[model samples]
Target: MGSLLFLAFAYLAVGQAAVNRNGAQTAADAAALAAAQDKRDQLAGKWVEEVLDPTQWQDIFDGFAPGLTPSCWRADQLASQNDAHVDGCVPGPLEFEVSVEMDNPVGDSIIPGTEGRYSTESAIAVIEPRCTFELPEEDAGDDVLPQLTCKDRNWDLDPEDLGDLPAPEDLFDVHLAD
Candidate 1:
């Protein structure tokens, strides 16, 4: 009876540990996906490929869990020693790993959400800039602080776009509309 009880307790303890490790790994994985998606979303007007770089996504990984290692699927931070991808993938389904490990985007994390039984499923993506426009910088007198001009930052007006040059009265109307 004593041996059976001891064996049962040992089994239960081992199972508990497995549960904790799995839970932590799940957390890391989910956070990685979230970070990747957010990183890509933020690069709407910048280089999509560079923004998706694993190294650049470190801060997002760190935010998932405070101390998860690269070995852990949901790392506290990145675990790219030499293998750089910003996507913290490793062996085991808990983390991102590939047979060749050439920075393949795979893996999932289970993070609980409010009023939900299923975990959040998210994937990283790159957002391309829909348009590109620039505004001329206003001349600033030599002052320590930058000047604050309330004028509109966008002044992309094509001379040809205006079929007929506006009169002085029309110019005032255009300025007032802006």
Candidate 2:
């Protein structure tokens, strides 16, 4: 009976550790995705500002929008929401990498060292442009802008009337990196 009880407690401790590890991974994934989505929104907004200039569209699609702010704050916020804290957040051209640690360690585990140890995990998220456009031929009028096709949907942009613009999700896709 003593041996069986000890074994049960050991299994419980392992399960607790596994749960903490999974939670940490979830937090990291959320943080990375939030950071990438924020950057994607910024790029889409920049594109809307430079709607008439087809030359700048390519650069924006490639995640080269100038004067944009860092997106790490968004990652921190997301991590906090998941009961974790972001240890590191790195922003790439169109990707975000985030590492998160759980706020609480596995408590009172049978494993001696597990009681005070917290789980940490890292995740990466990528932003991919979903829209494509072809510049107008030479001698084309300045008022005529090229039509943008995004995810099989046609977006005919009129410089004079700028109301019906694509949302951030339509311009870029945010997903966890494989």
Candidate 3:
């Protein structure tokens, strides 16, 4: 009877540790995706601003110096929402890496060292752009004829038609990498 009781307690402790680890992993994934989405929003805003300026279109099309947005703020906010805190937040070109630790430890005291220890996990997320600008080589007496191509569809750069452009969310895709 004593041996059976000890075996059951061991199984319960292992199960509790697994649950705590899964919660930490979930928080890390959410934080990373939130950060990447923030970067996508920043890129879409810059694209719109540059599209309006005909002179800036060439630079953007050539993939010149692109603007960057700090996304660690959103990562922290998201981790907190998931009952965790981000231990580290790193921003890349269009991605973010976030590590989070659970607010509370695995409370089942069946395990010795794990009673006061919290679980931690990390994840990476990326944002991909879906549009590019193209210009025709035809010289037409200095008339501006900039073109915006997106997913094999070409759209005219009419100032009035700017309203017809895709929404910022549609302009970029954000997802967790791991």
RMSD of each: 19.1, 1.0, 2.9
Better of 1 and 2 by lDDT: 2
What lDDT does model 1 reach?
0.30
Distance from true location, Cα of 69 in model 1, Å: 22
lDDT of 1 by residue, 1-178 (tens): 9989877866665564455444444443444543333333333212222222323323322223223333332222332321222333332212232111212222222222311222222122211222222222445322212211222232233323423322222111110000
Cα TM-score per model? 0.29, 0.96, 0.83
lDDT at position 25, candidate 1: 40
lDDT of 2 by residue, 4-99 (tens): 999999999989989999999999999999999999999999999899899899999999989899999999999999999999998998999999
Tell me, by TM-score, which candidate is best. 2
lDDT of 3 by residue, 1-178 (tens): 9999999999999899899999999999999999888777766677777766656654433333366647799989999998999999988776788999999998856668887899999999977666666555656433455666667566676765667765666567788885
Top-down TM-score ranking: 2, 3, 1
- How displaced is residue 45 in candidate 2, in Å? 0.6
Q: Count the backbone clashes (under 3 Å) in each candidate.
A: 9, 0, 0
Which candidate has the highest lDDT of all?
2
State each model's CA lDDT, in order. 0.30, 0.93, 0.77
lDDT of 3: 0.77
Error of 1 at 47 (Å): 6.5
In candidate 3, stretches whose alpha carbon ends up further than 4 angstroms from where it belongs are 54-69, 138-146, 152-154
